[model samples]
Target: MPDGPNTLLDLNQRSREVFRQLVETYLATGDPVGSRTLSKAGSRTGGVTLSPASIRNVMADLEELGLLSSPHTSAGRMPTEAGLRLFVDALLQVGDLTDDERAGIESQLSGSNRTADGPLAQVSQTLSGLSHCAGLVVAPKRQARLKQLEFVPVSPGQTLAVIVFEDGSVENRIIDTPRDMPASSLTMASNYLNARLKGRNFDEAQRRVQQEIDARRAELDELTTRVVEAGLAVWSGTDAVSGSAGRSLIVRGRANLLEDVQAQEDLERVRRLFNDLETKEELLQLLTLAEEAEGVRIFIGSETKLFSLSGSSVIVSPYTNAENQIVGVLGVVGPTRLNYARVIPIVDYTARLVTQLVR
Candidate 1:
């Protein structure tokens, strides 16, 4: 495939119209467009004022330029992924979403909950229903502020650290302590953390507490320090400590991909896509990349290895919190032929709606 730089300006007016006609027809029918079909087509269907022989020449030129390809089964041509990208970047006409559509989106997302990972399941499910694609969401990573931490002797050599957060959620971690250890050490560890961990999340508390401990500023015995360290370490990967949340990946409506399946190859592609979606860790990692992007991002087939085998596409946009801070991302995953002009605004509008609701 030719990968050198190319743009719409390179094509003459006839070539551009033929390319546009071919792509729009193929996208509408999920079938190849034949030169004869374009020649006899009516104006509404983007009929070109050219003979079949002339249209075939244009098709050959587009194929040579790597903008179109023909399936072995037929002599018709269809746009390649590169061609689709060019069309989206240049020719696609995206109109504003209707007032009813915006109101409907707002109606669906209006809820009272407020947090980083708030109401994601509903949001994704709504996208799937509307777009007829597998809806995906990446919940914001958030750590609740630490409220109180307590140590209680559980067994001969085990102790439980009862962690409480400002959000009223409690988690217990059991650690090993000396059988004859003084109860004063547990009390001392509790006093140290409760005083230090109340207002801060585990990450902030770790930094401050460890700095003080390193500087010998904390008035704690060695055993008590070990107890404190153990509690902190146990919470390392939890939402209380990690930068990403534990429940961050949400995928809905995998079967919606089958709605457009026309052939056995289409079924096979959906099967592969299903497998990719099932791999939540990798998919979530891919979606998290959108968190770093400015606005809507389109990942066409072969652009990302995760969906390369399936020949799928992902259209994502990051949603923001009240302060215009990007908190998470949400979007749809579907076939490359998904109506880009239509769905781009949907994803963008949904992201903005989520931003308003999240705040």
Candidate 2:
């Protein structure tokens, strides 16, 4: 075995071919691959013709190079994380998804509008179910600039804050008015804010209103300002319902993680990974890797801390809107020994399909 990080670079042609073939087989099946198995596999050209003893010597060399690990009982070897990365970057040959797979994806993605629930969530769930892996999606921000506001009295002290965006999407939040504040006062506050902010962005309008309040320039009582601030706070905080640019995450197939054979060691780690996926913020941070990546991004074991504990892998791709702007991310999470050659291209194609559908 070579002494350093450049070990793979120093390997002879035959040894390199043998290592690559072993890594490929191990990736396809999460099990140790023996030399005899390689010899009898018939997939390789003429590289596997060596005797079993000769192949074992090569396997020992690969194990020393940090590319393969030999189990105590089995006379076979499996690729390590470093080995998998090398194979993924230099040795793996990714193939295109078949037409049947594409049609199945299309059929699953089409279920979004057929139900009352959000389409993006449906897409995420469907992707997870089809892949037999965890699926995640950053939901699209559908809210546009706020265009109009209306307040209607639903009860004595409660009014519905109807917010209309430039995109024609509308949302309402029930706000509690001051017990002594009259309906007329609420209308005055609504009108004042609309006149100053009808054509402006929500965040910008919020900042301007805050500045005005700070300067004591707007002619209004403290109570009216309080009511306006309360209404805006509710709207801003619930961006999902209001269609603002706040982040959203949906994850499915967490149960698939438990099926991993290696996860039997300290299952708590996998539990943390699953729990982290539930929160929108933490999940967004994980998906943020896809934002900076070009096309598709693959995180194979220990490449990211969020997934390191689970000893899992993630493949993500960004999906864009009609304007060619990246609107969200979609991807799958599975065991590290997953079929990267197959899944990588599948994920890349799924990202493109999602972009087309959203457009």
Candidate 3:
């Protein structure tokens, strides 16, 4: 504990016990803790044999090390963000979830044949209930494989581009048509796409079609080129091998912010957290690091730039398809002082659930 912000550590048994007691009491009551109160909590276990005076000295040392902060003119101390991070990562010992907790999560994630939104919404609600904090879930963009492309004339100057995916997913886009174009033009483009690019993804179709159009420009009319270009532009914006979907987000449990226990000291940070959730692109970028992770990954405050503004923490793990190709991610976002021991396993289990669903 020499200088500027370092993670909390207590090597000796006595110091460690004192530190643990402080964090446990603070978490339980959400209050600034005095040394005498911690001494009583320690005495119940007969683990820490320090007197109040001695505990105060230890707390002073911890505060000096940037582990605990003392309120002005108050004989009480609380853990800083760094201290809470260290407690969650190394010190806290979370027991197995109770049967009810297991059931709550399982009931939502298992044996359900609903849309992707169903399980995700359930996850957000459950997390909020369990943690008494706001919950968040970013929806995974749906990417359906291509089956057929059909163009139908919707109006004199508008045509409907209907793309049917192999998975029975359908997407439609409207494109402007050149005046005096024949109905046969629609038939020609649709037949051409089905003959050449059926069973391929939109990107593959785009590349092959572009090559064909370029090589056979002399053989094609203006209407065909416009139809192909419109189709390509529409598919390019999807969450496939083209541009980004910019990510989807879900947040639950905002009412947990009204928990009456924690003092109304830094409520603004929590407010900022909610506001940040509204702009999910930033959160998705923050969690995207998990796509490259082997297992669950934790990003504490200041660890990544995406979450720097609010000093929040994220626990993320990627979900994969049957082929082991990563498809999406599942995670939680909360204050830096979150119960990592509990939430870490929750996120891990949810990631597995997502994988099972996609597979």
Candidate 4:
């Protein structure tokens, strides 16, 4: 091993080979790799001809360097979180999705035949099924362009602001009006807004409506003008107009976390993870970090604060729309022992496919 910033690169060829074998074995079985096991396994791979005693010495050295650890119950060695980071960042050779895997992913996202749950939900389900872990997708906030507006009078001082979007989604918000407002003012405001706000997003529609009012093109009495302004304010204030005000975090395959519990400690960790997933504010913040990066981001155990206690890992990627604007994030969460080589490409491809279909 070498000192300074180049520690990972400075490992001797023998140490590197042995370390790689150990990490690979641990990832595959989620079990500690003993010196005897590494010696036999490495000899078969034609990489390490060292005896068990020599292998044990090397394992001790790696453990001292904070790359591996020994569980209290076994003399066998397992990679630490730092070791997994080093492996993922520098040592692991990522694998591509097999043809069958690709077909499976595509079949789940099949166009026109997808379920009523929508594409984002379908993608989450597909990823969860393929990865055998909890899949997460932060759906983009709905911002449909306005098609028409209506103000149906419910009572003397209440009116239902009906908003129709170009995509055919309709939203209704009840707004208070002056008790003495004339019934004819509803139609007046509706006509004035529909004339200029159609086919525009909230911000653009608001700007155009204001411009018309400033230019005096909105010919209405003071009360009718105020009513129109209030109607616009309702949609502009929040995503309530699109009926998705709260953050949309789709998590599927939560039960998969239960599949690999080896002990009481493992069970506790899984339970903590389940609790963490329920309080998604942290997960949403974690996923937001991926939006700034370009491709798949791997967060090993303790790297992300939210999953630190559980010692879990997350692999997230941002998905964009047809305009190439990042609209949401999608990924999987699993134990630190997740199969990165196989999961990385699966996540990347799923994100790309989602981008294409989302538009």
Candidate 5:
């Protein structure tokens, strides 16, 4: 046994080769790889002649170093979370997506008559089908610059605030109005905001409006000022109907998590995972971390708090806008035994396709 930094660099060439082969086999079959299996699978180890006894000695050393684990009295061994992390970080060789896959992804996302919902829905489904795992995407928040603002009377003390964006998107919010406020006050506030806030984002418009009010440049009665403030606040706050800072979270293929359940413990873990997905807050926070990542980010078992109990892994990559600003994140969630060599590139390509389509 060779030891130094406890990484792949620390292992002797033969030991590294054996460990790599064992992890690959376990990932493929989701079963432990015994020393005898390694001996028989000589081709996987570069035709190295390793007897079962010799393989067993290496497996024991790996287990002692916390890289492998044994279940019950089985002679085989499976990679631990740490082992999977090490392999993903160093030993794995990523594969490219096939031409058919690239075409499929491009066709789905790059339709001529595409609506926001259509591309996003198809992307999630495509990812789920290709990866055989649950697909997850943190949809970009639809924030548009102010094009027009209108206040219409709804009832005695309620006014409807209709916001039209530069992109032609429209949203309506009901705001409480002072009963004594005159109908002309609505027009006054609407005209005032439209002149100053056009083509400005929500934050920028709000700041400019407040600055004007503080400087006392615009002459207005207290009632009209309150009406203008209320109108701006509605759009500034999150769209309550959609939730999550106006961003949508898409999760598909959750049933895939249960397809391979072989025990009560496995079923319980799947149930927990389903519950975790339902709580979108945690998943949103997890995906937000990918915004700062340059490319793909892998979170193995126990590394992410939300999946610690479920022992799941997540692979995420951020998709950017034309300006290279990250607008959203897309990824896959599955068991630790997922084929990272294949799935990693699939995610990478999907993210790039999404970015292009978004632009």
Candidate 6:
């Protein structure tokens, strides 16, 4: 037996090769790899010629170091979450997207209609289909400089608030109004806002418009004042219909997660995963934390408190606007044994592409 290798750097060539081969096998099959299986597989990985007895000794050492675990009485070992982190940080061989995948992502993002739903939904769909994992996205409301704001009565108590942005995007929001509200009052409210929010961005318009309405309330009739508040309310995230901070949470491809559960023997862990996805606020908060880093971030199993019960992993990246501010986050969630080497680059490439659309 060799001296204990505390860190990856401490591992000699033979130990490193054996460790890599074992981890790769575990990731591929999501099963423990016995010493005999590894001995037979060694030739394929790097011509490792150790006997089964020699391989067993190495696995025992790895187990003692907390890098591998034995789930059964069988003489097999599987990499633990800490081992996976080490592999991802040092040995994972990230691959580039295929031509077909690149084409697929481009088609999805470019073909999406910029409706109230925005393009983020399309992104999640594309990622889910391509990655075969549950795709998650944290989308702040679409932003653009104010071009114009108009109000048209749709019915007795509902009006259409048509907003045009400098980026050539149009958004239509429905506002509830007094049952007998007149069209002239809606027009007066729209004109007043257009005068003040001509070149302001969404957030700025939200603040200034509300302040103006409150300051000049005496000059306007009660009906007109109500319209003004409702108009700015749409931007300030006060609309109950939205019920979010002008931000949307989308999780696509949950069916993909179910497929993983079917492949693995553990049903209880995956059931917990479904419950975690339903907790969108906590999941969104987890994704937001990934923005602190520059590139793709991996939160494996217990590393993310929100999904710790699920024994799941998240591969996420943040998308930024022209000012390089992180405006959205996109990623996938799956079992801890996900094909990290393949999925990491997919996330990295998708995030870059989304950044262009955001700009």
- What is residue 246's positional error in candidate 2, in angstroms? 0.9
TM-score of 2: 0.77
In terms of lDDT, the best-performing candidate is 4
Instruction: List runs of model 3 lying over 4 Å from the truth.
Output: 1-10, 111-113, 150-161, 173-197, 203-247, 260-265
Give the per-residue lDDT of model 5 (tens digit) for 1-359.
22223477778888788889999999999888998888888856455469899989988888877788898898899998888888888899998888997897777667634765667777777788889999998888666788999999989999999998899988898988998779999999999999988998877888888898889987777878888888877666443434455467899899888888988888988898888888887788888899876899999978999999988999999999999999889999988899898889989999998898888
lDDT of 4 by residue, 48-157 (tens): 78999998998888887878889997989999888888888889999888889888887788753443347788888888888999999988766778899999989989
Q: Which stretches of candidate 2 lie over 4 Å from their true place?
A: 1-8, 42-47, 71-75, 114-117, 149-162, 166-192, 196-245, 259-263, 266-270
Cα RMSDs, all models? 4.0, 4.6, 4.4, 4.8, 3.9, 4.9
Q: Give me the overall lDDT of model 2.
A: 0.76
C-alpha positional error of residue 320 in candidate 1 after TM-score superposition, expressed in Å? 1.4
Give the TM-score of each candidate: 0.82, 0.77, 0.77, 0.79, 0.83, 0.77
- Locate the minimum summed-lDDT window of 10 residues in model 4: 238-247
207 Cα displacement, candidate 3 (Å)? 5.7
After superposition of all CA atoms, the RMSD between model 2 and the true structure is: 4.6
lDDT of 2 by residue, 1-359 (tens): 34324545677877878888888777767779998888877345665677777888988887888888876788899887888887787778888878998888787777667432267777778767766788888876543688888777788778788988887777788987766777777888889889876878666778899899999998888777877887776765443343324556778777876775464553775676676575556567778778896798988878887777677788899999889989888888877877777777777887888888878
Q: Give the per-residue lDDT of model 3 (tens digit) for 18-102.
A: 8888887787666789988977876888756789999999888888877888878889998876677778767878566777867
Candidate 3 clashing pairs?
none
TM-score of candidate 1 on Cα atoms, chains taken together: 0.82
Model 6 regions lying over 4 Å from their true place? 1-6, 145-199, 206-245, 262-265
Select the stronger candidate by lDDT from 2 and 6.
6
Worst 10-residue lDDT window, candidate 1: 238-247
Highest TM-score model number: 5
